[model samples]
Target: MKNFKPIWLMVCTLALACAPSSKDEQTAENEETSIFRHQPLVTHMYTADPSAHVFEGKIYIYPSHDIETGATSDDMGGHFDMKDYHVFSMDEPGAAVKDHGPVLKLEDIPWASRQLWAPDAAHKEGKYYLYFPAKDQDDIFRIGVAVADNPAGPFKAQPNPIKGSYSMDPAVFQDDDGSNYLYFGGIWGGQLQWFEDGELVAGRKGPTDGIPAPDQAALMPKVAKLTADMLEMAEKPKDALIVDEQGNPILSGDNQRRFFEGAWVHKYNEQYYLSYSTGDTHNIAYAIGDNPYGPFVHKGNVLLPVQGWTNHHSIVEFEGKWYLFYHDTELSGETHLRNIKMAELQYNPDGTIQTINPMK
Candidate 1:
């Protein structure tokens, strides 16, 4: 009986040694799961070029999905090879964000060849339209529209590209009068073109097009009114943004007020706020104007200089608060494979935006 008791004691010791305590079990569980916050917004996937809007009392964020390449490339060049778009939503700012998954993919658009870049969305006549820019089979980038009934969509791409827009980063802005304007173009390699009577016409082409770089104001963002169907541009394109009140152009050589790409416009308190990622894609600054077609005076910075190589963003008001949705490279550790991040945007008494702190 004493010998049997020793064997039983040995068995008990082995069991106790193998089993973890409750606290240890809890710690292990936490280490296995990641807690996502509203600050970085969408953690599970890499998202960039956020186009946020309020739909049906909830904020929906449409961002370009940046897929990580397992192997390193020269200068981290191939990291920006994004092929899809994702829509993330939440009821409140600090609440848990829901990833609605890939709403649109590169394969869905037959005309689209590869590079699917920054996208924006708008709702009209009970149908939601997603504006996206991608390269065609000829390798030229053009803007296209996808349709869906819901905000979180399995969006159907329109058969053809938007007739006139020959650029990237398509942002759709709808006015209070139900009139919508489509803003599309990029800084370096994008074309500045317009639409008139549903036909595409060339506007101010960029330096890459063999057209010498224009002066500051001539280098501003482009805007065009959309036709009633919300697919094609209704009128000729206009240089509606980044000019001065006296109708003067800003210069690219002037580091302070230079225009780069990622043009995002939103009206706040009767002031037309045209915020954009300035030249070099590291900082975001904005200007204020009295009208949408702006001679927007350069207000100070929106997002202070960030660590990432390309800092693109959108400003939106949700639940009576304003937030700046942008991207950084904190998670990917490389400049190209960036992730979306957000900060609370503040405004001054005169309706100018306060400088946002750079993300660490």
Candidate 2:
């Protein structure tokens, strides 16, 4: 039998949803409460798949909310029963983060039903955009974008999901030139797929349908450019970043780098770092490339393995320091319930990232 723990935790990834919140409400909540005083991010509520971004001189975290499960599997609505998302922000280093409260909810998006999984955010042209993935009423997974004038927003939902997106873990990346890109896909047969310009670009067969794992590197990550408006894709998806020079994917069997899901793009010192969770779903790894569209070479692990069914993270620079934001089930007795955690990330003089020992 499969491990019940991982499945339980993954179940809450059933949908991705975000709703808009009023600025007055956001201010009221942040001023009234203190966060991260005890560390490990939010403790009062369960949050997972942390995607952190530095916006307008502040660090903001967009994470999935893990609600308690029901009496049984049937009662739980399905695994990953997430219905909404909250934005956490901090203005100063080593100070308590402020909870911006639920910025988006499932009910606000007319097209989607549930399964608010991992999400990412970006700022462009004075608008804050939330990129999320959720199951639509038709039972298909599609990516959606919600926009708000303020980072702490009562965001307005796009009438429909991104037309061609068909996977989970939607991430938005903005290059220094003001161009945007979306990275997504995850464990559907033990492999993840990629989308670009609202089209299917690259995909691989994996350990699905009781078949043996293929010799191909199953979990390779892919990327594509987004239009200036940050609402649509602008180019075709290309397979880059996680493969070897021969164009073969670097497998993890011989300790080679591999991709599972949760692809995050961060640029530092003019070099591109593509970080993601390994196929094991318990550890975070990364690769380096010269550009956003990469023939990225595998560097090494960014996060060691942890005690959870799934691991997700993002890299951000704040106050001249770099940090890796991720999650674990340490505080929760059950794997289905997870909370956000983070650790400082370091880079070698050669521009490679060092492995991180994430807090439980």
Candidate 3:
């Protein structure tokens, strides 16, 4: 009996020695969770062009709902046949996201014809406003406003689009002084090239063959101050100039730093940051200026190319941490059908942002 007891005790000791340590178990769990953290924020359906914001201690994402339409791919983005907007909310990053389904649709908008593209949201005086761009009956893109009582909304679209609003990707930036500004525009299919000296050229197809001469001043995005009611442009839209260290307008040929689409503005440490996609270059670049309307000096790329052709993003600080919300084609493996993602964004001591590589 004593010999049998020793054998039993020896087996138990060997089993305990081979068992995983608590630290090892914890590390394994963290690795599994990290894999999820890098994946899409919502996978039930495709969502892209995330315009994330922190509202009332919750993160609200206004994204373009990507649908599988058989439209052929083109430089004009004809394949991106989105027709509605959906609002997504999460208590925190990497947490469960709730899809508040179809906040605004094309059929409900009186002036919108088709193609509900990238959208952004803002809160003022206890009301939430959704600002989006859609093509009007004339096939020219126009920005529109919709209102809601809640962040996650079934918003009511205004009967008419904002007066003097053109182009796509409407990003509303509220400055520290309580002034709200609209930053918008995109070239090529977005049709910013069609406007010469602020007037549309009749019957002009593919202006400048899609770009100005290499030495020519690069096209600029438009910025306008919003009215007090947040429904109309307070004045004429002005060029939000992005320039080199020498203060020269970035040349049209410098695709790497040129403004193509997706304008986002956020302030940090009293400096205004203007970030946008360098469209065909597939990088998210930024510029810094002292004021909201800027002759902003170009910084560097905020994000490198992801798995898709288009990369749109928004930056917001939540719970004392900053995050970049962007999109990729990880889920559908198609450019037009993309999925939204979020990652932590960091800044240097000099206020320059650390370049984020999505492939990492």
Candidate 4:
């Protein structure tokens, strides 16, 4: 007779083979619910370049709404064809983040053509103002303003772009004395390199047709005081210089420390902290200054490179603790499709920020 296994033994073996292991179950759960550190704040949609703020005891995020447009990625960021903006909010750390939905869109702006990039928001005179950047009809990036009564807005855009604005990224810092300043500018596809001698020379390029030489002074982020109304720039935009410990300008070739884009300014212990992205190097570096309009001294990096080609962030203090809000390509696995994340930001006793590694 042929050897045969008992029915009960055969059933047990088959059941064990079909069941998932504990490790496999955990992995599947994490992918579906994203219950882990540095996980996306909202997994339902892609968001990037988060500009976080604390408004009325809640955390708010203004980020670029990323969508796949079929445009290939290029050095000029052709694939970052974002067209709208969204507002996200949370009651506290580890709380459910709420998506406030579409607050602004390219079609609503009278002058905007394409590529609605990063944005920021501010509250003044009991009104909420939304500051953003987009390419106008001429294909040149210019900053614009929109207004709404609520922090979560269906903001109405101004009929025209900010008169003296150019390039991309608009971050507003309101001082203790009630003065508001706007920080902006970026190179490459941001089109900052096209401006020469304070004028737009469309064909003009930087040193070596890309970045400045090692010894040359690095490009500076621009800053301007906002008018009392917060609708116009009080004066012409000026360079907010970033220099070394010895007060020398940081060199462009020092890609690790130089500014590429994403200018955010926050004040802690009466000292101004100017943090930004070192574009090609993919690091979030910072500088320290005494005043809002900075000749900031290079400090160090706040974050290492994330999973995507770009890194943009915001620093905000809530309920006596500070946090860093940023983005990466963790959700979609595509550079142009990103998601926002947050981590607790700690500062040393000497007022320097502790470097954070996203993977950890």
Where does model 3 exceed 4 Å of error? Answer: 1-37, 207-210
The true-versus-predicted C-alpha distance at residue 238 of model 4, in Å, is 1.0
lDDT of 3 by residue, 7-44 (tens): 43345545555667686675554444332335688888
Tens-digit per-residue lDDT, 70-185, candidate 4: 87777778889988899999999899999899999999999999999999999998799999999999888999999999999989999999998998999999999999999998
Candidate 2 lDDT, 1-360, residue by residue in tens: 122234433343221112244667654443334222224677778888988888888888899898864624322225677889899888855668889889999999989987888888889989999999888895557889999998877677898997666667878778877888888876552123333333444433333321225565544555668887888777766655587656666764533356667888898889888888774546677777888878777777888876666788888889899988888775664655888877788889988878766532
> Residue 202 error for model 1, in Å?
12
Measured by TM-score, the strongest candidate is 4
RMSD for each model, in Å, please? 10.2, 10.2, 9.8, 8.1
Ranking by lDDT: 3, 4, 1, 2
Name the lDDT of candidate 3. 0.88
Q: Model 4 segments beyond 4 Å from truth?
A: 1-37, 205-211
For model 4 the local lDDT of residue 302 reads 95
The superposed Cα distance between candidate 1 and the true structure at residue 50, in angstroms, equals 0.9
Please identify which of the two predictions, 1 or 2, would achieve the higher TM-score against the true structure.
Answer: 1
Write model 1 residue lDDT over 27-113, tens digit each, in one string: 454333322222467667677888899998998999998876563543313346788888999887877899998889898898998
Which portions of model 1 miss their true places by more than 4 Å?
1-38, 69-79, 191-218, 245-247
Each model's lDDT:
0.74, 0.72, 0.88, 0.88
Candidate 1, number of clashes? 4
Please tell me which model should have the higher TM-score, number 2 or number 4: 4
